[model samples]
Target chain A: MKTRKADPKGVMTGAHYLDGDFALAEGALAAGCRFFAGYPITPSTETAERFSERIPFVGGMFIQMEDEIASIAALIGASWSGKKVMTVTSGPGFSLMMENIGLAAMQEVPLVIANVQRGGPSTGLPTLTGQQDMMQARWGSHGDYRIIALSPDSPQECFDLTIQAFNLAELYRVPVFIMTDECVGHMHEKVVIPPADEIDLVERKWYEGPKDAYRPYKPDTDLVPFMIKTGDGYRFHTTGLTHDERGYPVINAEVQDWCVRHLIDKIDKNAEKIIKLEEEQVDGAEVVVLSYGITSRVAIKAVQDARRQGIKVGTIRLLTVWPFPEKRVQELAGKVKAMVMPEINMGQVVKELERSVAGRTKVVSVPHCGGGVHDPDVILKAIKEAVK
Target chain B: MSPEAKNPIENFLRMDRIPHIWCSGCGIGTVVSSFADALEKSRLDLDKVAIVSGIGCTGRVAGYVKLDSFHTTHGRAIPFATGLKLGNPELKVVVFSGDGDIFGIGGNHFIHACRRNMDLVVICVNNFNYAMTGGQVAPTSPEKANLSTAPYGNFEYPFNVPYLAEACGATYVARWTVLHMRQVTTSILEALNHKGLSLIEVITPCVTLYARRNRLGDGLNLLKYYYENSEVRHGADTRTLDIRFQEKITCGKFIDVEKPTFLDCMNTHLTKTLGEKFRPYGV
Candidate 1:
């Protein structure tokens, strides 16, 4: 991977106190996100507001679209135009965006969506925290496809992981989500943005081969097709249908199998490189607490509390949530007595942990129905029960 | 495959993917022919032109066109074209879709894009019903028109789309029936030449479902009706342009006025506010 410095025009190279939402906007600018189209929803609206206020100064464009569907659709068009694009939304808006997210997946369009999650099954809570959309983020779109999602537990991580989100989106050519909740999105913390040369970004790979041989859906060895910007004279065609290597729609079981499998396998096969998990005292521990986003930060306090009571409790904080870290979870399932997971939702990510554990170990879910974060004692009790 | 003589317009089509899903005697193919002719007459660089469509019979235009085309999700062609135009200012983006896709499922985007006056040429093929999904009642389905979803007869008032376009601030607005071949093609060419948001609503025949369900005759009979009952009213009042079954169809350019587009307004505002500090968007 060839790495270069961030453009000085976009990088705010200094340490400053900022909220997670603003930090995410800054992260996008630093990572070369020059276009953002979005609808303003609570907790996520700040990100859009920041982009609108700041993008023009940096030679970028920000469009407040009609709704989340159009926002994502606009992002796809911008992506094909050789721009790193993104959108920010909460639950209801996210729900509206689900159809186009499928389109982005089908077309393998690289973009970022900062889902600053608020409480919802349907407008459940607008200003409060919830991780209810984790499962929806993984499988919200109606189809078989794979996407990359990252969880940032703090304001600093929101800035850092958004950059990672853009890089992973480019590398995998899929929509990468920054899955933060109201707690993380609103929390203010000191974030140090490094110098321009210190930041590494993945540039969109341009197709340099023969124009006649260019096939929009044909994958390279790495399973990602190179992109050609619009007006590049290639004049290729793309659609949200089961297509052949030429990007022409081919509706049949044979082509469907070939096309859908590539969309899944591209990320599945690269899961090892794509998944990132942070472990603390997991080795030789009797109980491991697996968590992500704001719940992971809450789980740390519970882990420390459990240790004081002489329980051998460890922590595994998930940074990348979608490719699920199956290998590591499978390895840990055999070693640990049990695993306890706490999420702001009613057992979303914990279900993935259970799948990876596959009955090898007991998996306990600490479910919260949103509107607020979990109390440390709730997770502490779950950890204690898991070890027993 | 032997070298055989082909139509000259085949250059604009993905001939390999021909035998399109449009039904026999459908007017969508005629509209496509008119669009191709418009492109040929416009004399613009074909490489810099893009076609975007939402899901419908009309949406298939993107797949058939040999440009940088995108068959996006339903009702999203306007916003998608908005992005393409703003992202690469050099590209001329056009959105083509059916009335159901544009005004029914995608109505909000249509209004918002018009309100923004986004620089796009949007061609809506209004067949009065959702033809692709089996003839169901749509926003433009005339009152008392029978459809699958409204078998008892539609009670809701259908939209006068040309009025809606003008009300939402479209810089150029026109209406034409498929029978008006030369006028339809000329309107498309004029829309392509205009700089801001231009909309052309084409009344086409959905003979298979729409006509058969409503007891109307075949495609030719509908074309005959259009030829006999239509009135050419240049710059007519858009509010009176609604179509009723077997009624006089008022068709012409309803609104054609110059106004600053979304990009122009945005760039002008930024340059004035930020002065030299504002780096203008993609040229």
Candidate 2:
């Protein structure tokens, strides 16, 4: 696609050993995120700290708001003012941001929110890794809407995928989620950030015609509308209510149906273009191990061990979790005997896999309730049992 | 003459959105009138001005205004306005909502915004209850005041808004009843020109809810009560400004001083710390 040089001031073009949190901050700068508003929480605090330190030098603003609700609210405001923005928080803080997150969805404000997942169901484990919020990330806010969520497995992918998250957010005009865990957030690895010219970035499409003719909610061929930047002499009205194409509230069933369907179908209809996954050795395998986030890395070891034990086990690692690559799962289900899933929660994403497979094949879940990653031996036993 | 020809303020409002939801004799309309007068007199670029509001009876102000308005979620207008101002330092952001919105559910945001002195003009309409949701008791509900939730009369102590604003660090704090239209409009004009966080508490009569429940006749009777019992004490100490059940309501400018705003503090600190390497935000 189209590629251009990044702003030299924001690009830190080199290689360094860094944690996923730090890499995420660098990725934001390279992606032209000019404003960051966040509230500090464990594991996710480092990302905010890095933004506070680095954003000022790049001619950007970093504000530490009163709480997570204010943090996301500020990001939505900044995004409307024609700036790329983001916020970072963990479980409890993510819970607090739900209402404003729904506001962002209703207004179709483009922004990024990174959730460095820790154990939960009410702050279960703060300092430990957990994948308990996967389902929450998909349907955290009330109402019917769809969002793109990405999972990163390493510090390097944390850097690469965060840039992708911003691009997807701008492309669809929806809030994109970076669903990582405490393990990946704190783990240090070598991350190579390429030269500014090498990284591809997406700029928001601004309305250029007569300001009088601008319709804020009118979608283009791609189902994403052009944005009218605030204070550009194009004064307009917008709210968190069901609105018409002019962005004025229209309280009726027809308006509500039109609004909700666009919010949902934009991503649902374009699932193939938006979904991202990485597959290995599943062409003719009898069993496949499906996993994401930190569990995918651990599942690698389990799959190799199962292969050594004469079991034909394959692997599928989710890069984009939501818009769940269901069709691919449906096709793979017809050939494979069974699919095994191991995650940090009590089977959150495996539910989606089961829905896609729909009894065409056996679906097995190896559930863990936070605190730590699954032991490879535990997953290996599940993989062996699935083939039986 | 046509209806639009009769009202000179029609140009500043969304005329099609008229027939507003406010009840008869409710003083919120007068407050809106004063605000419109202030906006007209200021002569500032209306295109660059943005009004934000949270959910409540007063929250509908944004929908009625002709500026770049945002009707955000409940209790979130301040932070959202802070973003708009900082995102483009040229935008004059105003937050207008009811007392239950600004001080009850959104009290934390109000306190923090004042503490930072984020550049914004916050107009809090103190109707003393959550009138939109059928008159529930609020943080500003007078002690022993009658409300839906507090049917036995509210016994909880109410907030002294001026004192709270002063303690939290607002650069300008003022209170005026709806009867003092010219004075309240003048206060708003001053706040619009001020640089940092400025809060103007307008005590309005909620005719259908607060007034009817408390045995006040109508909006006119409550206005007469304010005219007779409310004492205009300019520069009064905010600590003694609490409104007891029918006691003399002390009103006027309480805190007016100069201090750097949140952006000023950020830019100054960063320029000194980073020197030539620093680039001021909103450039």
Candidate 3:
């Protein structure tokens, strides 16, 4: 294992080992993974296969369940049992998993789900990469509540974002999605696997009092419940329906409003703390380039190339997609006269950008369908036109 | 574990989801009561047990139980409980579903779940008809049995749950009607405590539906048939029970075979295939 060489401040240094997927996955194991359950689907299958191969060798459990529902259901059970758990699936499988994903949402089970998005609605373009699930990742699960989602633009981000997914899931006790398109998921890029001492590991919060006092579903002041694992000798209820502080089913209108709004507020209030973005050369730029996931890689390159030709174009890559990062965009949206958004789908983030910018900047989308990535030239042209 | 005073059944009940949706004079209530009695007698910790229910009148098993229970989508409880058990090798998970729910719409899941030999217990209440949705014909309803769907008489061949379970890799299979509450409770607890997929098929009656339609009298009279005509035996042959029950009703702990539950074999083999030492995130 080529480990991450670190300085005094623990800032990351140089690269070693294979590319992003392996490094991030290894980091997850080292960070305390005990269970990995998944269904074999393309682009993301290698991630599942590798985890299946590795999890057992490392004193953990691995299961290739019948379908996506079983896979996620297994993951939630494992997580509830004090295991660092995760599952990986592609677009179609992810669609099947949305119900359980919503269960994880309603039950507040902390876990990681990596979706290597592919094309189309029903088996659209399985082998090809498309960022089509960009919107689905945030809102696919029925009902309103906030969730934390991160998008990775490269192989390194794919690896790094996976660990980040586990960390965020643990931090907030919510399901975390690592939105990686096919380009990012399958690529073999140089990535250093961080050493145990050099990397930070996160564990789920638990009740420190007596087992009797521990409410696996009791809400903290933050509205997040302290969940104790099944074997830990604590009693708590986890319901898919709207629930009370004890986790029992609550059908009353007022309690429903409180639980739903609180679920949203947990993410919303902490948006500033939870959201992460990558901004490049936006200081005194007229046109800003916006994108996320693998599309952001092309986006950054487009903006960088435009800047080389003396055009004042910059880039803002959303590392966190679901929280929306409205404040960051609004502040930067005002400074930039126009913005160009490029993504795999017809148009998703552009709408969010349009909403945040409120017409202060001319917004344009360089849309690409299933087959492949949006060309860098296409994004560059959209930026130049927006600037003009 | 006493039956009435200091009732062992109280240990497994939610005490709140009851009085359940099960109708008065319903056989499901008897089965549920029997389940609690079995659990209490077996002396299993409530925390280690997970009772999962599918959609049906009998699917309320999870709701009434205090253990880690799940009231899942219709016909999907088997898979859901399979996931729960597979993830943790330590827990005893049970699927409590009704005949109409399991053999009718969820027949595929039921057969597949049994075939896997998933380490869990399955307590199925064979009430013959879909009582909750009003008198509807179920897959287990006797040929020529009348229900709303089969008002003229069911031309379809009904399922024999004991034979069904035996064919589907069940390590332990049995049949006991709700009329024999003590025997049914013992069979249920035996299934609960047993490893692998153990299914106890309770030949229950839908008093409100099947009883009213066939004039099987009331719940008391319907239960009377179970008491007088029911047969008890040693090693009740599962293969021949369904065939023999073609003319004669045979109910007992029919098939109890020894097979490694799916969980034990899966974990042990995975560990062996994986070799000596591997723990994902430790030094």
Candidate 4:
């Protein structure tokens, strides 16, 4: 995929103090997102508020949809109509969006969704922070498909990874998630926004072939297909139902097999290029603390404490949570004595970690129910236990 | 028939995808034919027109149409169409789906889309019961009608679709039966040109399930019933448009008035407030 500079009109260059949610909105604008349809949900509403305030000046559109379900549905429509679209919500809204998220995936619409995490099972803790939705972001929607999810632990990453999320969504033609928790979403920090020319963006791949020969689902050299806008005279049809390359519904098992495989392979085959991790001092370490989102920040503190006690602890922060980084985890499993994961949920991504480790090393999960982040001492104890 | 002798509407349909999944004697095909005829008469840029459908028998309409059609999740076509129109105000977005899909599961979207006056033409095929799901009782199924779920007889009051559309602020509201083919086509064309949330409810027969369960015979019998019992009242008060079991079916245009669409209101408001800073979206 080729890269382009951000539209200068949407970029606000310079350093400023902003929260994670507001920074996310700025990042989306910098990445050329022209349409945002969102509903109000705590911890995430600030993103929508910021977007509504700025998008009009940028020659873009913002709609506060009736609900989260309608919000996601609108994003899919706007995306097909030749716009980079997005929406933000918390757990309750995220649940309402699951059905349409699947539709967006099946239709191969490029979209960015920011789920500012909160404690949840059912409206569990709307105002407080929790990373419980980590797994839900990966598998909340039904089906055998893959999506790219990025976890931002601070306001700076909230600004940076969100632009990356839009780029990946355009490059792969799939829904990309900015999975940040309430701590980061509400945490105020200094964020540096580069000039429009300095910020790179991936443009949506548009089909430029003869209108008669255009097929909405025909894959390019890459497994991803090129898109055409609704008013482009292509007269193409696309549906959520399993379809053929022509974008017409084909219900037979053969077409279903092809459709499902294409959706999965586009990301699975390119997982290495899609997944990003930030590691420190992992070489020959006896224990590694593996975490993502806000939990990773807390876990790093524990890692530093362990290292001071001569525990030889290293830290691996997951920047991209989905597409699991299985190969890297498997390789590290053989060498490390154990890996300690502390997340807000009881045990979510830790299961994926254990699966990748395949029992090669001890895996300990420091689980917190919700409403708050984990204390560094608790994670430190888990690391100590894993080493023992 | 040879390829040269294809139907006139073949230009607007995916001929290869036919024969469609719609059952024999189903009136959905007749509605589709009317829609195609309307498209032809409107002479709007086919490329600039998009169709969106929710999941159901009518949802399949998107698949058969040779346009930028979207068969989205159940009960989401309205909001989806809203996005399409706002994304590119130059495009004419249409929502075509069944009564169950529109009024049952997707009632909230319908009301809100109408409330917002989203610029889209909505063609709702009201086949009393949930025909696609094996004749289950629907929000549109009249009281005392037999259905799969309401085997003893449906006791639920059916929605007066035109009334609901009017109450929710739809700019154009009309109703017609499949038997009134030319009228359906005329209303569709008018709605297409109308620049707000326009709704045309086409009462059609679900012969395979709805008719069989209600003992209403097949498509022809229903058409005969419509011919004998239907009344054309163009300006009837929408509040009196409730459909009753085996009763006179009221049909005609009940509401048609001009109002700024969602985009129109948005653009005007933003342009006024922001002055030179705002570039009117999709102008």
Question: Which number leads on lDDT?
Answer: 4
In candidate 1, what are the lDDT values of residues B1-283, reduced to their tens digit? 4589778679889888897898886888888889999999999999999999999889999999889989998888988888888889888999999999999888999999889888899999999999888999999999999999999999999999999999999999988889888888999999999989999998888999999998889898986777678898999988888888668889989899999889889989889988998877765
lDDT of 3 by residue, A1-388 (tens): 0123222222233575444455446545655666777888876787776666666555666767777776786677667667778887789999988877877887788888888888987898888889888788889988987778888877767767776787788878899888877777777777765655666656577777876565555667766677676644453546576777756666899988978887788788878988888887789889888888778877777887788888998778889998898988788777888888888889987888889989877889889986698778888888888888
Deviation of model 1 at A157, angstroms: 0.7
**How big is the positional error of residue A132 in model 3, measured in Å on the Cα after superposition?**
1.0
Collision count of model 4? 0
DockQ of 4: 0.85
lDDT (0-100) at residue A363 of candidate 1?
94
User: A1-388 in candidate 4: lDDT tens per residue?
Assistant: 7789999999999999999999999999999999999999998999999999999889889999999999999999999988999899999999999999999999999999999989888988999988888777888888888889999999999999989999999999999999998999999999999999999999889888888998888888888998889999888889899999998888899999999999999999999999999999999799988999888888878888999998999888999999898999899988999999898999999999999999999999999998998889999998888898
User: Candidate 3 iRMS, in Å?
Assistant: 3.5
Clashing pairs in 4: none
Q: What is the TM-score of each candidate against the true structure?
A: 0.98, 0.98, 0.89, 0.99
Task: Give a tens-digit lDDT track for model 2, residues A1-388.
Answer: 2345678778899999999999899999999998999998997999999988898778888999999999998988888888889998999999999999899989999999999999887867889999988888889899999989999999999999999999988888899999999999999999999998888888776778998898889988888878887888777888998999988889999999999999998899888999888999999899999999999999999999999999998889999999898999899898999999999999989999999999999999999998999999999999888888
lDDT of 2: 0.90
Candidate number that wins on lDDT, 1 or 4: 4
lDDT, residue A191, candidate 4: 97
For candidate 3, please provide the TM-score of chain A on its own: 0.93
DockQ score of the complex predicted as candidate 3? 0.35
Question: For residues B198-249, what per-residue lDDT tens digits would candidate 4 score against the true structure?
Answer: 9999888888897887788888998778657889999899999999998999
Candidate 1 CAPRI level: high
lDDT of 3 by residue, B43-118 (tens): 8877787777777788866777777766665566776666566556677777899987778876866776777787
Best by DockQ: 4
lDDT of 1: 0.91
Q: How do the residues B1-283 of candidate 2 rate in per-residue lDDT, one tens digit apiece?
A: 8654667677678777888889988888888889999999999998898999999999988988888989999999998988888888889999999999899888999999999999999999998999999999999999999999999999999999999999999999999999999989999999999999999999888889888999988889997787678888888988999998877888888888999999889888888988988977665
Per lDDT, what order, best first? 4, 1, 2, 3
